[model samples]
Target: METHRIEELERKIQEYETIISEMSAPIIPSIVPQTILIPITGLIRAERFDKIRGNVLNFIHNKDIETAIIDLTDISGERIEDVCLEEIGRELHELASSISLMGVKALFVGMNPELVKRMVLDGIKLESQSFSTFQAALKYLMKQKGLEFRKISE
Candidate 1:
């Protein structure tokens, strides 16, 4: 009787161990699609360029996002110093070139008065690279990919 009880207990323990092992098995993580939207804020300083670069790389690596919108709505309206404007233009040009090289599309939205003035003074012809608003930029970007824009009520 004692021997039988020992065997039964061992068997039960083994069964429980098996059940726990099965429950503890590693689970495969699910992949979810992510969208890329970056908003530029405040003064256009050199440090901000790093944020933009990091954000771009992060989207490319983590989200696999091909479309990005840089909104400059929060930027203050003031005359940009020539040196600062030059730096800003250089950064913009670099970002545009980088996105184009990576086969990604980038649209700069929110053309504030200060930005317009700086662009005019610097003779920076953004052409299709910049847009007046996020909605228009989105439409233009979608159009470039042969996609139709759907109107959403604000």
Candidate 2:
């Protein structure tokens, strides 16, 4: 009788161990979206410019990224000083020209008031371009890529 009780207890323990092991196993999910999002961070320094320029060119070359958002809202208002603003204007103009040359689309994001003023005063020359909020930029890129646009009715 004692031997039978010990065997029954061991069987129960083995069942519990199996259950615990199954519960501890990691659960892998199936579906994931393929959109890539890159954030532009920090001041408009040359290093930052180089990194961004390299990434942009690579993405353009590989045809992986559909849209690149160059957010400017996080930039310090003081950083938009005359010198930095001039640098930004030149970089943006060059970026736009580069994208045009490569036949790729670049969507700039987060245009602060100071940057806008500087662009106007300095004549940065991004006038004949398209830019918008992050969501709008994504939608525009999708539309440009021949994806179906969900029409909005008036």
Candidate 3:
């Protein structure tokens, strides 16, 4: 049955494509327990937001992710005309609010400079604890949790 082999190959290809699609939006585990980092990068399309939100919410729902730090440092602005940064800002605020309602603290880090400038001019500000970098956010969380980094062996 050559047809059976062809069907199996098609199924495998579909699975691989789905995996690649999910991998496009990654969620990383942090050094601290109950914390995770989600770095938003590249041109985030409107349709992709639903998938992103679904994945993030699903992951958080499944695990004890107390704090979620979203890093936007790598978010590209090359396709500035294609999407509205203000809309994205609103979405980010909504996401943070939703995470908070779930008993999780959602922080932001490293917002793109261009985005910041645009949002400032547009009077769109995200109401979340934002830091300059991912490390800064991590340190802030660690301090809030009564933890600190120490060199036990150097």
Number of the predicted model whose TM-score against the real structure is largest: 3
Q: Which ranges of candidate 1 are over 4 A from the true structure? A: 1-35, 78-83, 125-128, 142-154
- Candidate with the greatest lDDT versus the true structure: 3
lDDT of 2 by residue, 59-142 (tens): 667554334455555665665434477677777777656655666545566677777788789877773244546666667656
RMSD (Cα, Å) for all candidates, in order, is: 16.5, 16.0, 3.0
Local distance difference test, per candidate?
0.61, 0.57, 0.81
Q: After superposition, how far is residue 51 of candidate 2 from its true place, in Å?
A: 2.8
State the TM-score for model 2. 0.58
Look at candidate 3 and give me any clashing residue pairs.
none
lDDT of 2: 0.57
TM-score, model 1 to reference? 0.58
Measured with C-alpha atoms, the lDDT of residue 90 in candidate 2 is 78
Residues forming the 10-long window of minimal summed lDDT in candidate 2: 25-34
Model 3 stretches astray by more than 4 angstroms: 1-17, 79-81
Residue 130 lDDT in model 2? 45
Q: What is the lDDT of residue 135 in candidate 2?
A: 66
TM-score of each: 0.58, 0.58, 0.82
Candidate 3 residue-wise lDDT, 51-99, digit = tens: 7777888888867889999888877577443578887777787788777
